[model samples]
Target: MIDLHTHVVPPRTPFLERLAGSDPRWARLEPAGETGDVIVAGSNFRTVRRVAWDLVERRERLAADGVTGHLLSAMPELFAPWAPAGDALDYARAFNGWLAAEVTGHDGFFTGLGVVPVQDPVAAAALLGEIAGQGLLGVEIPSAPPGAPLHDPVWADFLGEAERLGLLLFVHAVGGALAATFPHPGAANGVVFPSSIGQAVGGLIAAGTLERFPRLRLLASHGGGSLLTSLPRLDFMRATTPALQELMPQPPAVYAQRLWFDPLLFDATLLMALVDVVGADRVVLGTDYPFMGADPVTHLDDPAVPAALAAAIRVTNPQRLLTSLTAPT
Candidate 1:
């Protein structure tokens, strides 16, 4: 079955030295041991696992895990929203080059979803065209850039270009400011991060992004991030808030059904509920592979889910999304 939500990093390159280019603000990764600390703007942003760069081992393990094909994006921590525009674009091109080369080597076994320097929409759109021309699936973007909302005018411009190019967009949380506001300190337990994805998705729906960009296909990671459970509250709010209704012409849950989601919820009932909310056709297999949350490999075979629905989630749905590999007619 096609796994829609896996990540890969290139074999270690001189990311820092290449982008530093006399700029002190460019982010760098300082290797400590098995993992490395990411330094951005003079502060430790986060730590990354070494397995993220072990491409060959990861490909082999995916086969063993029953994933016939998977999508690869730069590790989210490397998005480097803090970098200056020139450095950020340089990093995007460099990373996309590595990804295209890897996909060319592996061909059908792996497809690429490259990254763009989202802080600059003009550069991002230009680079996105290059990525689509390379036959990669599309682009992976952070839920939002550092301090901006996903539906801001700049993002709208970039997304407009994405839709014109018929590219798919995958939204994964990168633990920005929103992650820090979670009721708990540290937010490292993985709870706050996925919850932030839910909030991001809600924001997108409220902003009428799908309505504005009808052809823009999106895949929301982490079971669409609490979306399945939050629908009742969202709809209730819509009913009470006339202004929100004006912004969201339809119910929030309806907008959710049009987007795709990865089944990484780690529970059978939640998987079933995800299907119930967004339909099996919108749910795809995702392992978050080679990371702490990779276990259980739950293939949506829960007795709670219908056999037909499970098959769709595992196989039928991904085929539709994969069609983006072809130039859109």
Candidate 2:
């Protein structure tokens, strides 16, 4: 099995110490040891003991669970999107560079999704080009600004550049930093809602951004947050509205076919629903590993799921997404 959404941070203590001292916006991160473990405290989400597990250790752990490979993403807070663009870019470069160095030695055993300075698209694009050449799988960006809808035109250039580079784009939800008004407030407390991520994705699709860049592969964390439900509406609007029909090459469903969804939905019912909506080929496995509520392998072990579907979710889909990054001469 291949786990597509595990996380790692730079194991260098100096970098962690520097970030803790300089960035008051990060809710006080404290480096606890020399082996790249840090205690991140005072955040809206649950506090976590972030540690860097060596490839051998990680392999052994996964092997115990029958997982053969892992696709590493940087821990969410480490991206520090709230920081100034220049500082964010520096952090992004440092993190990506460190990830490349660590993973390059392991080959197929490990792969990574690079981080980018989302605050500045032009600079982010340049950094992405460099990382892409290094054979990184993709870049991670927030669904939107702290208090703004993701569909805001501000992020267009960043999305456009990603499309041009032929890189996979992963947009994961950040819990506390979501825009002020929750997209859907009626749901029960424990239930998973796809509001913010859905809004961001919907905004991009409605604005014709995906239409403009046909080759871009966008993956949304948390089963793409309400996007599956919203797709039918988007399709209806496209069919009934003549102007939108002209703007979009096909219906919204066609555009969705280009987008990818991760299987972070812990419930078997939801997972099967996502598979029906996005189809098996577009869904990848994401563990959000080491976080309290996320366990990717649990979904893999569910008896409700067919073996063939589980294998595709666990291994085949991730292989296709990462292998797409091979640089052409």
Task: Give the whole-model CA lDDT for all candidates, comma-separated.
Answer: 0.75, 0.70
| TM value for model 1 | 0.85
- Model 1 RMSD, rounded to 1 decimal: 3.3
- Top candidate on TM-score is 1
Clashing pairs in 1: none
Maximum-lDDT candidate:
1
In model 1, where is the ten-residue run with the lowest total lDDT?
290-299
Q: What's the lDDT for candidate 2?
A: 0.70
Q: Which regions in candidate 2 have their CA more than 4 angstroms from the true location?
A: 13-20, 27-55, 146-152, 177-193, 293-304, 327-329
